[model samples]
Target: MPADQQRTDLLPADALQGKQLGLSVSESPDLDRLGLLDTHFRMTLGELARTVIIAGGSLFYGGHLQPGGITNFLIEELQRYGRRDRPLKVCLAWTVHRAMTQDQIAEQKDILGLFGEIHFLSPVGDRLDGPVNEATIDDPPAEERSRALTGLRTFMTANTDARIVIGGKRAGFQGSMPGIFEEVLFSLERKQPLYLAGGFGGAALDVIRKMRPEYAEWFPPAHDMPVPDDRFLTALERIEEIVSAVQWDGFENGLSEDENRLLSASYRPSEIAALVGKGMGRLLV
Candidate 1:
């Protein structure tokens, strides 16, 4: 992002009008290695949410809705600004919704109703088949639960206009692939305005490593990290396949290649919001 473009005054207030942005983020295992703290990630998330709402856009989050979880965090952010009822959209997969007792679900629904809507998605069918109801399954097969989350991500992608990815875990995910890797692949598949804020150094940075290998030097070395299993390696290979077809180097989000390079390596929220605001204002026009 250029100095002038980053000026807060230059940001487009209505860049996201009528557009919903998908947020793909998680607790990264390597935040420390990148000289970041958990608060840094949390602050960035709040800042981005604030930026989006202020810019006349809503948000979508497909995750749990615990008291202090990301879902509520966004809800809290939405409350900070005025809008139509339920400015945020929270998507819940059958596997996740069922994990909580019906009473808990009811309780959450009551709270979310005030700030955003909750979408209860039935389990996906076929190979990763799930029942077609909101009923909770007790101790579902590990694979079934994981597949359900994958289905939720797909549903979220179908609904949102663009995406911003940041801190993500590499493994131990309920989904077949690491959630971050799979979600990024889906956004790439759709050619949605994808932004990879790799500066915080997590799985998002890892994904960028594949897209622009020459920028490998921008990330922290991975020797001390746990080795990824064959499954993770295979998922990563899928990223290359997706990006190759999409020509991701072209900066499809109304930004120049140079601006995107800066986006991938920036940790500041102001710059992220400005880059996204500028790109969306033009790309979405």
Candidate 2:
């Protein structure tokens, strides 16, 4: 294929009417090198959201790699090209007791104010307490945090039309890699349109490397990609070991009953997008 033809856009314009589009991005430390790829991906997302709904996790919304460091970038794009009769909606999800501080939550709320709805996923007993600071509160157990995050991810996947995972470093440790991995897993289980946009090296790329090595030609790692630290390498090795041990049936058996239920309710992006194009309206509410 010619290089121009090879540089094809993934989603067709008419395919996005009222569907929900999810974006999963990494907060990689190599921001300078990855910025270009991030910009292009964001632009593509912006164009796609001219009609469809765009949804993403809060962490990526405020990350430095995003041009302008606010979710407004997406909102602005939607406002620019979206129809007045049927405005595009933006959806953001965040956890109540995760690594984010109260100040961070307030900041995110301000950005979300310019766009659409924000979903604050939380546990039953956790309450939003006192003074907001820059520091993260570690009150929740690791297991609780993981489960809560996974549940939120499953909900997002179940509700969204498609998901696009972009950029990052270590497969399991760095930044939002674990959450991204979990989201990808849920998308896979639901058989949603999950596109791994691995222009910058990250967990999305790492998983592609692990599961679909033959497609490496399509997504090469960044030229100046930093070497993984010992911790990252250890985590990667552990992931390889786990992947080696688990068969398809065993992997399916590992999920909890709730996860199974969420997967069962999920819809394909194209199906939802088609429904939207035909005036069935937004299914994400």
Candidate 1 at residue 25, lDDT? 93
RMSD, one per candidate, in order: 3.2, 9.9
Global Cα lDDT for candidate 1: 0.78
Off by over 4 Å in 2: 1-14, 28-70, 82-114, 124-141, 171-177, 217-285
For each candidate in turn, the TM-score is 0.90, 0.54
Tens-place lDDT digits, model 1, residues 1-285: 657745354345776678888999999887777678878888788878877777778788889888888888887777777665576888887777777777887788788766788777777611223223456576888877887888888888888898988888887777788888888888888888787888888788888888876554677476777778777899889889888887763258887778788878888877776777678777875
* Residue-wise C-alpha lDDT for candidate 2, range 198-224, written one tens digit per residue: 444456666556654654444456677
Candidate lDDT values, in order: 0.78, 0.45
